[model samples]
Target chain A: MITRRLPPWFVNALLVPLASVLCGFVVAGLVVAATGSDPIAAFSSLFQGAFTNQDAFAETLVSTTPYLFLGLGIALGFRAGLFNIGAEGQYYVGGLAGVFLAYSIHGVPGLIEIPLALAAGMLGGFVWSGIAGALKARFGAHEVITTIMLNYVAFLLANYLIDGGLMLAPHVSTPRTPEIDANAQLPIIIAGTRLHFGLILALVAVPLVWFLLQRTTLGFRLRSVGFNPTAARANGMSVGQTLVLSMGISGALAGLAGIVDILGVSHHMTDTVGAGYGFDAIAVALLARSNPWGVLPAALLFGALRNGASFMQLDTQVSSDLISVVQATVIIFVAAPVLVRWIFRLRRQQVAEVQITQREETAAV
Target chain B: MEFLSHQDVVGLLAQTLVTATPLTLAALGGIMCERSGVVNIALEGIMLTGAFVGYAVALATHNVWLGVLAAVVAGMLIATLHAALSVSLMVDQIVSGMVINILAVGITGVFYRNYIESSGLAGPDTLPHWNIPGLSALPVLGRIFFQNQFVTYAMLILIFAVHVVIFKTVWGLRTRACGENPAAAETAGINVYFVRYINVITSGALAGLGGAYFSLQQIGNFLPNMTGGRGFIALAAMIFGKWTPIGAFGASQLFAFSDALGSRLQIANVHIPIQFLGMLPYLVTIVVLAGAMGRAVAPAAVGKPYRRS
Candidate 1:
């Protein structure tokens, strides 16, 4: 009967977010009440909306795909001590690239067409993120600030493309690109469902990421640099190169998510295509504690929360934007773990201290 | 003929200078905080709050200076919370600054919805330009500077004062000391936290004034998120100018020039794609930030909280 110290594992994984979910629910409740809505009905509607039917499930899956991508991108960067805040921009550029490539080469063969579109998206992300990496390596530009500013630039560039050069659709009223041919689209998985093969790819990425981080030398180098770049440098690791490489990889993952969006969900590129996923991904990655394995549950939770918000609003008259509030609260809680751990640790410390004093008294006796 | 060309350029330059007034003020505030060891990324939010409060308060009181005073109070109040979190709790500077920004936006949005959505007070009385009579007659300079509103004059005074205080005063030296190396300064008996507190709050007040310039002086009403990333531009300017008040002001002028040029290009029908041209400031930020990498170094102990532990 190896009862092993399961407390550590449980506390780290389950308790923190479980506590946050509870707090989030309470905040949501207070918010609902503030708006003269019933919390119980709103919450019920939230749960019902998120899982009410197959269509809702499909929407959840659709939303989950980008979360998985951005989550993974952010997770990998955080693990490598590289804060890639530019994934939103990467997603934008990557989506743009896939659209540009798909439209640019229309007559490509069937088998290779989808792969080409995907690779283009990945390349788009790779090139965009590579700039930040190169700068961080060559010139020591702070990735955080540079990446953030680049988000605006990417947004602007996307505006440029959709409104001008890449305006494939004739109407062109909105800032979005033309839809690719049916062949370029991702094949739908379930019959009569909006769910696409992106879910399959995201799931596949989970294990692949786990393996890459755990089993490879590159992973070791990344982790070492993350822990202490100076030490990693002394040990012959090229910190700058690693920074750049990891950024490209991060961008590639985010870009792949964009490819999924083009071929799977929206089937076209638009100004509001990514829809704040990049910023939300930051919250998701941080809440998940930047763990790849941990991202699954975190993404699903956020997916459900986001998916249910519309119902919460429609049923209760509460602004569904309360979702943003809860999301932010969860991140704040996660960012400061010491605040949570201190409360629990206090009791344990008191008990242990008492035991030590008691044993000393007995010895004196 | 040469004199005419210079005069033409001076007229253009004078207009550019007039347009740059608000930017220079805000950018100056940005430098104050960045140099004093706080990022003050919420300069945009602080400016927005000041714009709304100043405009609304002045509109209610029928006094522009009172509105400006109200904006100062509002800005100081919000900055106090920023001070509490950053200086007292020692939270992540960027994260806290961003949170302040979001909160300011949220609060203002809510208030505007409540107060202005169905009300007439939303359209406030504009501040009249304070004419320096002789300066107003100085050909192109008169139209640009003297013909401008009071806020522009205030901004110029503030810029001069900032340059003097930053370069000449002992307090400024201590503030710079805190930003550069708080530990060594702390060892020398200067309270790092205290100096940072003053700087951050003062920085907040200056940013508030910048906001007043926007709503009270320019548009005359608080449109939602009117700062429109100008605060961030000011931030870029701070880095571009190598963290000096004057240098940052020059960067602000450059940004204001680009914005003016971008608008002019739209009007003049330049061949540059509208989207690409619209992206000028953001794109420039990326380029400037990329180039500023090694050249601009933040204060060594700027983000680190001073704890004995």
Candidate 2:
């Protein structure tokens, strides 16, 4: 059945996301039009806002930084057959922990203070998500429900701390923590823009995660447990330990995202710090099909939409929420690749897709 | 104990029932969906859609019942999409559910900002409270049980009705068969897809009514994400109840009690931080799931997509 065609990898990796993105835009445009705005004008403004506008591209990269880490975090969890729905909470906890570290310490070199704060954030996320992982491992608790429940708790905890409790800065008009020390903040990489050195850390994370998933025994165990926990257990791998470690690593990445955002951009935590980004990362991971490399473009697309949304709203008077519609549609198409194949009239590659889903079903149970 | 007077008990119980209304309805819906072997984390989104549509329709027509009907239809429509994706298209149910949730938030937010927020029209207001003539006069019991809004009454009745329908009927048996072992059910002449489709859509209808609790019954106007995390809380209640209609009702009451007690403590100027009180339900859910009582197992085939070879 071999025929002259583009490689299956090319189609699955490249063509699929590209077509899904197109379908997402089309669906989003219809929504915009239904809301009595010109979709063309809205999309055009959205593009300009994301790229062509002054320093907009840089800001888009800034947004991409968090999505990059969050997407990678969630994707890693998916690799371990766990759905980490509490990334938002993990992010909040990370910020709380990282910011506490950032402001509490006295004079030190930026180099010395930055890594410590980042580690604190990662530790926070790891601990928070590890609770769910431990529950899942020990008691067979479903991570989905536990993680979501934890998200709400995390939000409340963050709100309590920053709003008027321990972390609140004195003499501030608004409820937010005091600004971090000058040494703790990440230096801006680009002059005249908000882009900071965390982008380098985020960029480094991709290949590092790729290496971790591809070339490491831990990665193999995670993938094996995700593929079939029963078989992995039968093969002498400790499924419980793998689940815990997978969740811990996932949370650590998300924590990295949260702390990076604090050190790089905001420099202080607020109640609304990680509000919707955590949920959006779920879509990002879905779009990436839980592939670490795939997360790059997916996160970038989401970052662009997020960065451009406000400008789109200002220009076309279309609500910024329209971007979520686009994200949703993109994921819908990604999740049902059959629909995409049918729509594009591509050759049916049913076997691989079905096998992947079958494994997912087994893992899900 | 001294601060809790007779009137406070009655008021607290009444508030507990009021808070339980939406959680119970949505949990009942979760029971229907999951019992038929489909995971429906999209209840939150469906409820949000129902709330928005219910409020919008009620606002336009100035008729409350029509709004309730519209919410049900809207929920069913979204569930149909879920069915198409997860059941027919063989998409992962979780991914499909998340998509529906995001779409609901986006669509509802866009519509709410564009039309509802700026309409300047007042909502028809909460569904009329129906007072039981003789029971309404009773000292404490009547106030806590009988006097209520339309949805609360329906919720009370639906709990009993759903309990019977799930446990004591032929359709119930088939649905459980589908959930537990669809392959065996199909071999024995059950249409697995049909049962799942019907149950999932019906769950949407129930959840839609739950949404009306927010917009049409409790508040006159719809707010973006006003369903908040209640839908997720309901899912927690569903698991806490072990996927049974009656059990879900009990779990919803427990959650509602915590919520009511939290507000009560806040009013009473309790020394504990309010955020800690707010964390009670979620923390309770984690504790429950972590096997405080025991592991509450789900339907065997709940999260799996069935395929007939």
Candidate 3:
């Protein structure tokens, strides 16, 4: 049988995501066609807009920076068996904190100011997320509900601050904070593009996160708790403490995502700062199967789609909302690998055999 | 500050009912889905689809009931997709629900812009209010309860009816058993899959009715994301109410009261920031969940797909 010859690892790791992505594009094309437009033209222009020139590529990278940080943060939470859905709130609080600090410390040297702002962002996210983590740890309140509630509170807080004169920029009626000082701004990497030092920071995070997850005792404890909390507790691991620590770390990363976007690109905290990156990062993490190393490619893919969407709309008169459709489709396909296998006519693997091996591994552990 | 007059209290109570009706319906729907062992985070998306379809059909057909029927069908279609992915395909329930949400936003937005917006049509007529002659004339109670739109009255009836059905019937027993232990339910000869599918689809239908309330009963027009996280709020309400239909209704009333009060305060020129007022419901939800959720036990099999070995 074809299943006998198939490599299990390739099917599980690579082919599933690839097939899901292809399926997503196909569905998106059909949606475009339904709108009475030429799908081929739409897709061609989407590709062209994403990679046609250095400027466009740079914009894609600019978008990718936040996704990388946010995705890694969410991936970490998933590894620790926590769903930290309040990344949006954390991002908002982080940006607000970073901007507030940067504005207040106006006379500091560049070297000092930059790190201070970034640290403020991380601290803000950590504290914001810690509220939910603490609640979950102490009260057994589900993180999903707490995080979602926190999102609304965060938005309202940001709105209040921006509109009530606390952070509102002088001489402007719009609801936004004052721009960060030049000392706090991240240096641009590309001469004529928005690409900034945030890209380097995001890349640096990848190795650091990878090392922390794969090579540390803390990582082992977190993973063991995630895999089986009862067993981990029996072996002397404190599940509640691990949950709080992992969630705090997750929030810190998301906070960094917010500050990077502000310092690298936006330069000011606005009502729309971090916009949908927190939510989009969930998809990125899911597509990458919550793997830190895989987040780079996944973030890039999402970045390209977002970057290309405006041009797709400009060129074909298609609504940029189509990108959301494609994204949803990808998530559906990826989340249900059985559907992908069935669509591709692949035989089902022996589940009994897999279960026995899993049981054996648990027993050994 | 002057104490609110009797009439003013009645007015606020009436407004609270109007605001709470949609949330009650959606929370009841959430209760049904969760009681059947499915975690339905797609309530927001399902509501959006229902609102869009409900408004579009009402405008096109010039019939509100037909629009409601179409909305329910559209919601069921999305719910079917959710059921297929989460039940048959064994996908992560939360992820499946999130996809449904994103898909609904995209589909509704694209369709509304391409077809509905370009048509240059005005908003549909609002649903008519029903003034029950004898009841509506009966002082403050009458004004608070009887003098409202048809959907508001229907929602009140539904709250009682659903409470009875969920707690007092044999079907309810099997459904609860399925959620608590699907393997045991299967052993007992209950069709667990069928019960889950039916409950989830019915949940979607109720959510669709709630969505129709937004477009038809409240605003007379469908706006993008008009549900505005009400669905999530409803989920919080479900948890807060300990997943009981009547309890969820009570929680919905609490949230709606706060929402109504916030708006009233805004109109009365209160000193508190409007943003802070907007934050009240969410803050209350957090406080309630943290205080009460530790003792709220979820179904053992919730979020887990059952596959017979």
**TM-score to native of every candidate shown:** 0.86, 0.96, 0.95
Top of the candidates by DockQ:
2
Q: Where does model 1 exceed 4 Å of error?
A: A1-9, A21-54, A107-111, A166-168, A190-193, A272-274, A310-321, A341-365, B1-22, B49-70, B104-122, B213-216, B274-294
The CAPRI class of candidate 1 is incorrect
How much of the real interface does each model capture, measured as fnat?
Answer: 0.23, 0.74, 0.61
Put down candidate 1 lDDT per residue, A1-365, tens digits, no spaces. Answer: 12133355566566666666677677656755654557788788888878885588778877888899889888888777777778989998888888788866787774698888889999999888988888877766667667777777888888776766555577767656787888777889987888898888988888888787778998888777776777888999998888788888889888988888888878888776337678678767776777788888888877887788777667755555566657755654554444445544523322110000001001000
Sorted on DockQ, best first, the list reads 2, 3, 1
lDDT of model 3 at position B115:
73
Give per-residue CA lDDT, model 3, range A150-246, as digits (tens).
Answer: 8888988998898878889999867788888887899999898989999999999998888888899888887776677779889998877887888
Interface RMSD of each: 12.8, 2.6, 6.4
How does model 2 score by TM-score? 0.96
Question: Which window of ten consecutive residues has the lowest lDDT sum in model 3 chain A?
Answer: A356-365
Residue-level lDDT of model 2, residues B131-231, one tens digit each, is 99998889887898789998899899999988888899999999999999999999999999999999999989999999999999998789988998899
Model 3 per-residue lDDT at B18: 92
Evaluate residue B19 in candidate 1 and report its C-alpha lDDT on the 0 to 100 scale. 69
Pairs of residues clashing in candidate 1: none
Q: What is the lDDT of residue A105 in candidate 3?
A: 77
Q: Look at candidate 2 and give me any clashing residue pairs.
A: none
